[model samples]
Target: MNLTQLNMLSDAQLAARVAQDIPDGSYVNLGIGKPTHVSAYVPEGREVIYHSENGILGVGPTPPPGQEDLELIDASKRYITLAPGAAFFEHTDSFAMMRGGHIDIAVLGAYQVAENGDLANWATLDETYPPAVGGAMDLVVGVPTIFVMMKHVNRDGTPKLLERCTYPLTGLGVVSRVYTDLAVLDVVPQGFRLVELTPGNGFEAVQAATGAKILT
Candidate 1:
């Protein structure tokens, strides 16, 4: 699929695509944006544990409409149900888990990613909206694997996966994989490797639309 075609996928479908890549028994942190949708699509009975920076672990699916507890929400502040062994603690303990390398995987959203795996997703140069880095830095540096979930192209048709990032850097050489609407790419020493593409996408079509080179 091309960039335009990718935009047509429903949010639930996009979330489901991301769900397929998460491994069983992995401890994962879902970033604030689109990455938070990942929990709803994790395959049933997989035993994957979801963590929230707000100090909750083993988070389950979204709660029923009228059952949301104001005090119990995920990092996205969305109402969520707790898993059987879920626990909650102080925020300081939460940061410790993230900064101390306890997380196995982190799924994040990105504004730009360089060929060599530099990431810049928090802010743009525009001052209209204030940018917040939040727990992203902690996740990138402490987690063993970082997966970025985002669109392939910017609003003006600029490629987000690039030869070099034009936005402010978030983490250097830390990204492990990229799950875009068009394809899934693994970040390797040689650069982004094309592991899989959507139903209608071709390798050449994806290459022409991206700034980074894909391993054939």
Candidate 2:
């Protein structure tokens, strides 16, 4: 089936969906790219402390236009605001927070994710651009829960949720859940377990889009 025919969630909508699942009173890190959008949609009444690997805690939503602080940015180098009681520290301290298990969750983007929860977001086969793993390795090992936010397929219409990742693994069996444009899935011992389908998307359609079998 053609992807355009499916009523897939927009990036903002997908972010909001992921935001709704995050528990209150958690310290979370949003990976660069699509995952960064999740920060702006945290549900009201919940207190989620956002952490930037580049060294900022209590990260807030994106600042309104004309209110941008050129000096303030997240790991993605995108302009951001600070929530109340925000703090800044050196990179050493920032990494320590990530590596010391102080972070509760890490929402990251991915190139591919295997059925067994293997993540391959850091590097791909394309040699044009240098591979940058960033803090993903640290977060996957230290943070208790890992939520991946990414498109369900590549530009060529190949699935990103696969039986086995074709790219280099960032961390073995690290992903807890995956939120894609079509559906939400949990990494279970059996494989990709369908948690929920995006509105207007059917089970079979989503399964066809996925490279691996999605357990009901």
Clashes of each: 2, 0
Error of 1 at 83 (Å): 0.9
- Give the TM-score of each candidate: 0.93, 0.94
- Give the worst 10-residue stretch by lDDT in candidate 1: 1-10
Writing each residue's lDDT as its tens digit, candidate 1 over 1-216 gives 245544335557778998987899989999997988887788887888889999899888887889998888888888888998999999889988988999899999999988799999888988898988888888888898999988877777779999889888899999999888777898899999988886677777788779989986
Instruction: Report lDDT per candidate.
Output: 0.86, 0.91
How many Å off is the CA of 101 in candidate 1? 1.3
Q: Write the per-residue lDDT of candidate 2 for residues 88-157, one digit (tens) a residue.
A: 9999899899989999999999999999999998898989989888888988988889999999988778
Whole-model alpha-carbon lDDT for candidate 2: 0.91
Error of 1 at 27 (Å): 1.0
